[model samples]
Target: MSYVLGIDIGTYESKGVLVDRNGKLVAQSAVPHKLEIPHRGWAEHDAEATWWHDFKQLSKSLIHMARMNYGISADEIEAVGVSSIAPAVLPIDRDGTPLRKAILYGVDTRAEREIAALNEAIGEERVFEIGGQSLSSQAAGPKMKWIKHHEPEVYEKTYKFLCGSGYLVYKLTGQCVIDRYTAVNYAPLFDIHTLEWNDESVSHMTEADKLPALTWSTDIVGTVTRQAAEQTGLAPGTRVIAGTADAMSEAISIGAIHQGDLMMMYGSSTFFILTTDRIMKTKELWPNVHIVPGANTLTGGTATAGSLTRWFVDQCLGRDMGSGEASNWSVQQAYTYMSEQAGLSPPGSNGLITLPFFSGERTPVHDASAKGMMFGLSLNHTTADMYRSLLEGISFSIRHNLDVMQELGASVKRIVSVGGGVKNELWLQSVSDICQVRQAIPEITVGAAYGNAYICGMALGWHDNLEEIDEWVNIIRHIEPGVNDREVYERHYAIYHRLYERTKDLMKDL
Candidate 1:
């Protein structure tokens, strides 16, 4: 039987999977990593140490598992597909050595100043016309310009600018390439109409030569080299496709490729991708090209979700309870305990509401200076209330994005939910109640790694098109919205909006 390998580099971890053409997962593995926050608003990762290092580890481990557990050889793996937290800004030298730590996705708001400058220099509407999106922290062009303005020494020596997935592809295949879906986030630098890098916009940021070659998400760029093969334990000359962003892969993992298919990826952050037939230009959300050609999607994200929960554990619960064994419980066990605690709390968090902008606000608000808040806090409230409120806060943010998408005339025929968040029953049900949408949870929630494997299948012509993913994915269950909790959530959601509008200025001042 033939097999393919898929790997994804997430914010806090990386996962890899090996699968047969029938979509049976042969082997799977994961590795944990840290998301560095060096400054107040800066988030980064060492490209060589974290991304490439983790990829090699996961590859070797998964390949070994396929051989030992499933009797599959390395030669059986036909193609490799990769995805990562994307639209990141990673500068590399001519020899493909990372010059500095990679600037992460919208979670890092260090480019706020650059965003304002670009919007001022080129009118916001003009930019929207050019790029089909607004100038926000999510835009890679602003972050690229940030390096040029703040780190001129690093910028001057840069050979090519790459995203997380592109960097991994370069390490494996010695080529610098990005998918159109991922490249669309490189606003102004990439023209949505032409579907290529714009030479005109290069003047505002780095040189034109610094841009990576663009291709479709499943397009095979090259094959694994001998050096990369030795490090990764894969056979030499294995085809490597130009992988796209993780959320895109996650969306495809569950067969959310058609128009009006909304994918809510609840991982380190919560990202929403609404696939559409044509581009919908809105300042509130990002217009992205679909991995499949001649299609578009509107993307939105919160700066924090599961990461905020981690913060709560680290800050509220002490160090021993946060990282180490709390009553001899593993970290996952600790979270399960916390979830049980949260279940004890009533909905609306018993009059407590949280704004999950610990990093910043994305989507409709797009406020970099936005701060996290817990309104209606009282001495009577317990840890359960606080935890539940955090989950509710993220759900409110999801509703806010869905409202924006609906206002833009986008339809939502189906909602395919993926990521670690699906495991939390309280969180999943709360999102359903708060968002008033049913979520289709796939049986195999291994996420982007599985999606990567299928994309590899496509690259190898095992499937005719995106629709074949339906054969691979099966909906195990569905979470329908709760009618009883709607009114209470509606009232709290109002307060959630007002709380932000009222205190945003104070947050900026601080």
Candidate 2:
């Protein structure tokens, strides 16, 4: 049977999956990598070492598994698609070698100064008017400007600035190109209305022509390079489609295609929602290009989601619990233990609330100085109690974003949870209880990788459109808020909302 390959380069790992035309997974493989935080607010990745290496390893492994385990051949693969974290900035030389390490997604804040400078030059209102989004350290334009102004030597030799997926696409197709959703994050640099790079914004750059060509996420950018084919164990001339940001791909995978459909991605960092219909602009929320063509509206919330639980285990409990070793008590074990502990604690973690701004905050707060806090902490509380509160706090923060989206007229009827965090049933239930929204969990939790497969299927004419893609995705589980827990959560949510207000000033001092 003919199959397609979908690869996703994520913040902490890279994954690739092979799926048949019937949407059955033929093979899958993943390679984990480290994230570099050289400075408090800076997150970097050695593009060659972390992203490309993992991509090569995972892609080869997946292909190997397909051939060895699933009896699928390289020639049977019709197309390949890729997706990755959005808004990363990686400057590459003319030969496609990375000039410096890649600046990661919104989590990295080294471009704070550039963000302010851009806002000043363009005027904040004009920026919002033109790009439909506000400038953050997350925006690619500011990050590119930071490199030009701060790292003159590196910036001078740069031939093109590419994101995670763009870099992968370059390795595969020998062409540097980016999809609209990822390119739009270069706001004020990209014209959202026209879906093209802004000429005036380019004039601000020292080497403006270095940017990659823009295309739709589904557009066939080029054929696989012979080098890439050898490294990835794929056949020569395999078609490569321009893919999109991970969140957009995840949304597509879960049938979040039309207006009002919401996708809640619970990964290392949570992305709350994305909708198609436009809402009145708000300073507190992000508005960007949707992955689907002609869909102008996109909204999201960002903060510690699964990462909070990870922090608690690695930093707080790992050493003491004898789980400090790489192989001992995996993240899965820690999550399972935490979930069990959360079940022991009552809703709201017995009135102890946590602000999961460990890596700083995003969405409504947008404060880089925002530090995590555990309010009403007492000597009586255990690590389990703190962990439960942390999970709930993250959920409350998501509800806060939901409230803001509602205020801005984005209708969220249902939330489809996609990612690793969904594996924790307790956390998933708590989120549903806190948000008071029905949660649908897909049979496969591969998320963006699966979404990329769906897009590739469309590109290869296996499916008619996104709606057909949605029908192929099977829903294996659903979680609805329990009536008793809902009332208790509402009361706790009131206190959860107040915790942010009460601690806002104190966090600034930190």
Candidate 3:
């Protein structure tokens, strides 16, 4: 049987999966990696140590599992595709070696100064027209400018700049190229209409030619090199496609391809929604290239979702959880325990609501100064109550993001949830109840890796198109909002919405 390998380098971990032509997962493996924060509001990853190392380890292990456990050979692996966190900026030398650490998506704030400077120079109107969205710290253009201004020595030594997926593609195929979705985020530097780098945008910067060539996500870039074959245990000459941002890949995996279908990726951060049809330009959300060619639209959300819960678990609960522990008790034991304990309290965690802006926030409120806050904390509430409130707060933030999309005339009827957060059924149900939207969970939650496999199949002619992918993408379960719970959540959501506003001024002082 022919097999396809999909590898995804996520913010918190790296995952790889082997899937057959029939879209059935045969084997899977993952390795955890750490995110480094040298300073507050700054997030960086050791591109060589964390990303490339985990990619090699996960891919090799998955290949070994397929051979030893499933009796599949390397030759049977027709193609290999990869996906990773979007908007990561990594500068590399001519041979594709990372010059320094990588600045991660939505989390890293080293570019905040640059964002302000660029916004002042190129007004929001010009940025929206050329860049397709208001400039945020998440944009690659400012991040690149940050390096140029702040670290002039490192900037001068750099030869090329690439995202996480592009870096992996370069490691595999010895070619540095970025997909349109990833490249578009580099705007004011890339023209969305022409699909090429805008010379005028980078005229002030030096060595602008260092940007990687752009390609569609599914386009074949190059074959696996000998070094990659040895490192990843794949056959030399294997095809490697130009991969996509994690959000677009997750959308593909969950069958959120058609117009109006939205994929809410609840992972390290929560990406709220994806719509196929384009809407009027708005500063609150991002409008960019869709994974599927010719499908223009909007995608936006909070920068912190599951990451908030994770912080509560690690810093607050102080529990050591193992990776891939998906058993009922193991997967959601912490959340379930906390929710049960908080249920005995009352709605709004007894007047306490967490802002969950630990990593700053995207969507609705684009304030980088926004800090996490716990409102109405008195002598009455326990730590468990605070934890539950954090979960609800994150869910409430998602609802606010969705509301913004709706207010901007985007139709969001159904949502498909995919990522690490989906492993916790209690959280999924809580989000559905709070958002008042039907949520569907896929049988497989391998996320962007599985999505990349589906894209590989389509590129190799195993499937017709994205619609066929939806037909083949299986749904294991669906979570509908309970009438009573939905009503209760609506009342609490009103309070949740107020918490952000009430605390916004104080957060700015922080």
Q: Which 10 consecutive residues of model 1 have the lowest summed lDDT? A: 320-329
lDDT by residue for model 1 (1-510), tens: 999999999998899999999999999999888899999999999999999999999999999998898788889899999999987999999999999999999899999989888888877887888899887778899999999999999999999999999999999999999999999899978998999888777678889889999999889999999999999999999999999999999999988887789999989999988888888888899988888787788899998998998788766666545444444656677788889999999998899999999998888899989999999989999999999999999999999999988898999999999999999999999999999999999999999999999999999999989889999999999999999988999999999999999999999999
Model 3: worst 10 consecutive residues (lDDT sum):
320-329
Give a tens-digit lDDT track for model 3, residues 307-419.
Answer: 77766765545544422243323535666665567566655566677778887788778877778878778998888678778888888888888888888778876788899
- Cα lDDT of candidate 1 equals 0.91
State which candidate, 1 or 3, has the greater TM-score.
Answer: 1
Candidate 1 lDDT for residue 23: 97
RMSD of 1: 1.2
Q: Which structure among the candidates has the greatest TM-score?
A: 1
Please write out the lDDT profile of model 2 over residues 192-308, one tens digit for every residue.
677788887676754558888998888888988888898888889999999988888888877766667788888888885566556346678777766557565556657578666
Is candidate 1 or 3 superior in lDDT? 1
Kindly report which residue stretches of model 1 are placed more than 4 angstroms away from their true locations once superposed.
320-327
Candidate 2 global lDDT: 0.81
- TM value for model 1: 0.98
